[model samples]
Target: MTTDSTRRTPLVRLRSDGAVDEATLAYARTKIDAVLARPGLPAVTGEVRITRAAAHHAGHPWAATADVRVGRRQVVAVAEEATGTELVDRLQDRLRRQTDKAAHYWDDGRGTTAPPWRGGELRDGVSP
Candidate 1:
């Protein structure tokens, strides 16, 4: 049976312009929820924040960062790509890698029991 923990994870989005329409937000939320719905994944806690980053240099395209808390650990994924096809392609590649890594880390019990933040020691700051 599916547990409630697996069903209550919330996905959140942060837009650069701070003017994201409902439709866009909904679409992003749906995509993220789909990803988190994978089997055997733990009940994720907190929301995944996706925000667009400013351009670093002239002619440089925009970038985005996805940060989320899985179990007791925080995972960050970043991607930068030019506008149009380049942007989409690059973001897809980077996001895929980031998600895969995060999934592996979370599922393999690497970050679940002994989080690296506390120097492998049990502490209040560390997540379960």
Candidate 2:
């Protein structure tokens, strides 16, 4: 995904596969924007594809997929839920976690002067 500095923050290109209502799409945009607007996040541009199963008896018909780039890191998250509300909720949570990890990629407790074998992290007087 390419970053567009001139565009709005959280530039989400959304696409739907079924009769998804405008309200639902708007709701998704709001949730996704909130996630992407967090502090420390890099310039992100991505797409979210929403699909609804047409089968009459499908339990979880709503599906959402997100492919986003956080700085130099790339994250792809997908989820399926029974309703639009649930779908967006899960999608935002996934996005939040993935972006958080990406934004803090350098602080993964690695490259430290002390390694785990050297009591870098001690608990109960024992190495964990």
Candidate 3:
């Protein structure tokens, strides 16, 4: 549905705590886009965070976290790796697993949510 004339914002947003290279971001985008492109997904929006650890953690400087929403459900993925390649690769796997799990729990063939008449959470009446 996307064409050159019309540009749409990416479904997944990317952010970094420190200097993350353009190449790395672009690669991350591609991986995340793949993960978010499920057939039954509805209005998926996500934020991916790439954090650089302190000097002590030089062996694994890269940390990636993705917070993704599928309809009313939310899933998070996190990874720590030695390089950008590893970070993104692990991120993709983690994100895919989390999203798939959410889908399994929430998505039914009917695509309809539970009726509000069913049940609500029981609130604790005890006060502090």
Best by lDDT: 2
Candidate with maximal TM-score: 2
lDDT of 1 by residue, 81-128 (tens): 544234434544554465566666765544445565655655665553
Better of 2 and 3 by TM-score: 2
Candidate achieving higher lDDT, 1 or 3:
3
Each candidate's TM vs. the true structure?
Answer: 0.48, 0.73, 0.72
lDDT of 3 by residue, 9-63 (tens): 3666777776677778778777877778768766678788887765864889999
Order the candidates by lDDT, highest first — what do you get? 2, 3, 1
Worst 10 residues of 2 by lDDT: 1-10
Error of 1 at 11 (Å): 6.5
Report residue 68 deviation for candidate 2 (angstroms). Answer: 0.5
Model 2 vs. true fold: TM? 0.73
- For 1-128, candidate 2 gives per-residue lDDT tens digits of 22212224536677778767777877887887888877767777778888888885999999999998877788899999999989999999998888888888834445555666875666555566
